[model samples]
Target: MSIGAVLAQLRGDFPDVTISKIRFLEAEGLVQPGRTPSGYRQFAAADVERLRFVLAAQRDHYLPLKVIKEQLDAADSGAGPTAALPRPPRRLVPIDAPAENVGLPVADDFTVGKELRLTREELLEQAGIDAPALAELQQYGLVRPGPAGFFDPDAVLVARTVKAMTEFGIEPRHLRAFRAAADREVGLLEQIVTPVYRHRDPEAKSRADEVVRELAALSVTLHTLLVKAGIRGVAGC
Candidate 1:
């Protein structure tokens, strides 16, 4: 089928489909459209299906292009059916011998074992957070243990900070206010990052990261000014 006809059909499913977006996906190696002698792009039925899968995964899963690429690569490598989209590759590296000495592990260098579920004590040790502080953050609804008593990696990082704060005599109740403030900050960030969620372009992905970091810096600046103003207000100066 011609690219335009494929696009027209795709627009039924994705109303905002644009030529540039398709080109961007192609550039990301998500879809490979054949070209005619006249240089017109030709998209087969399989191409349309691949685009549908890519778009659906992006919209529903919030996966980035790099991750999606890895999934597609894995599928292409006989890991599974090419048409049956898989989740992002979980293996840290590929499963094969290296062609040359690259100072990296060959797939056989690593051992694959059954997923080990960590206990609460092991989790605390790995997360570098004590029990009490973890409970405090849980009370504040800032973080929670995931399935099987594990915590998300990001949550573990935050838990460590909460633990450190407790060592400095900061109570969990006091941290609850900070959690509320953080929610507001995150809401602002979501507003700015929403556009990045719409398409799967590498440039847009980079800009999204920059936008999130910039928003975080802006939030810190605004909060500092507000705190300073409040302090001066109390001092009657």
Candidate 2:
């Protein structure tokens, strides 16, 4: 079908999509459109399906374009969809064996664990996040455990973040700033996604997800670079 017709159908599902966004995805090599003899764009059924998959993954996984590119690369290599799967498990080795005796496990051989919901206590124990950290996060509204005293999937993520911060010598009180910073960051992200929310189109949703992932990665990279640069300047001074 013509690009306009296909895009119209897509817009029915995701309203905020723009020609620019589709062009941007094309520039990123995420989607390739065919050209008619008249130079108008033509998209086939498979192209629409591929676009749907790309959008779904971006929305759901928040994967960066580089990561998505790697996944597509794997597919191109005839490795099947297994290469797109999550990281695999470490191989079991006997502790008593010599260092040279152990063989590394294949990178592709990994297990996908079931999603586990943890209670407050279970989350603390499993994630090694202290009580004070949990309390601090709660105070900052970074997370809320369910009424059943169990943490949803997001709480597990919070628990992991708390654990990592502690390892970095960040005290619970010091971490409160992160909660505020996160709130501000989320506010910005919401504004960015508003267009997608308003349109409710599949392609717009996909574009929203792609934008979010790219923004997040760029945020992290820029934040880390600036922080390190500041630290170096201070040390040199």
Candidate 3:
């Protein structure tokens, strides 16, 4: 089943289910659809059933994805598909713990929640930026959120940096190059890790994560040294 077929099958009930939303849920580890050599998503009937469970959990039970994902994970491991699952409380969304991604480790201590959760209003206030400014940052691909509608801590840092740059008259448009460069770096990294991630081995996933962290650290170091060298050229010292 192609992604389009899955969308068509689900969208009658889940009208807001866009392709990106499905991809976001995949990123959250909700469903594992196979991908083609050309990177097209291929959903199976089981994937559709899982997607339905997620939608029903959110819409009928009013459960946050975190809680729903836990139940799903339990079921996937041994609880028997959709059997003997605990009923979720019909309540507002709670503060979420950090999610373990394919390679991400446990959350580190940060002033903001270690999971990097922030509502839009909270991010604006903390970053000392306005809504429009934040919107511009997102528009320029400098920041983004998951489908769960929470910004990561990096988004707040980006907002703060952009705000400070505004003092020097640097605007979001001028930051497009930064976004482009970051995208290129990510593309290269993805090529290196995609095969490891596709493997179903726990150790492979761990190795992939280590590769990600080391490469990311190296990239940052290179960026910092280049910036320093550029500044020295202006200082002439």
Please list the C-alpha lDDT of all candidates, in the order they appear: 0.68, 0.63, 0.73
Per-residue CA lDDT of candidate 1, range 49-96, in tens? Answer: 788778666544545567777877788797856655533332222334
C-alpha lDDT (0 to 100) for residue 48 of candidate 3: 85
lDDT of 3 at 69: 85
Across 1-237, the per-residue lDDT of candidate 3 in tens digits comes to 998899988755654457887888899999999988998888998898888888666555445567778888888888747554333333122223122211222111111335868999989999998889989999998889879999877888899999999899999989999999989987987898899889997756755665665556456546765886798899996
Best-to-worst ranking by lDDT = 3, 1, 2
Model 1 CA deviation exceeding 4 Å by range: 1-123, 126-129, 145-170, 232-237
Best candidate according to lDDT? 3
- lDDT for each residue of candidate 2 in 91-171, tens digit (9 for 90 to 100): 123334445433332111221246567777887786677788778778867677767667776677776876677788976
In TM-score terms, candidate 2 sits at 0.45
Regions of candidate 3 where Cα sits further than 4 Å from its true position = 1-114
**True-structure RMSD, every candidate:** 17.3, 17.4, 18.9
Per-candidate TM-score against the hidden true structure: 0.40, 0.45, 0.51
Looking at model 2, how many pairs of residues clash?
A: 7
Better of 1 and 3 by TM-score: 3
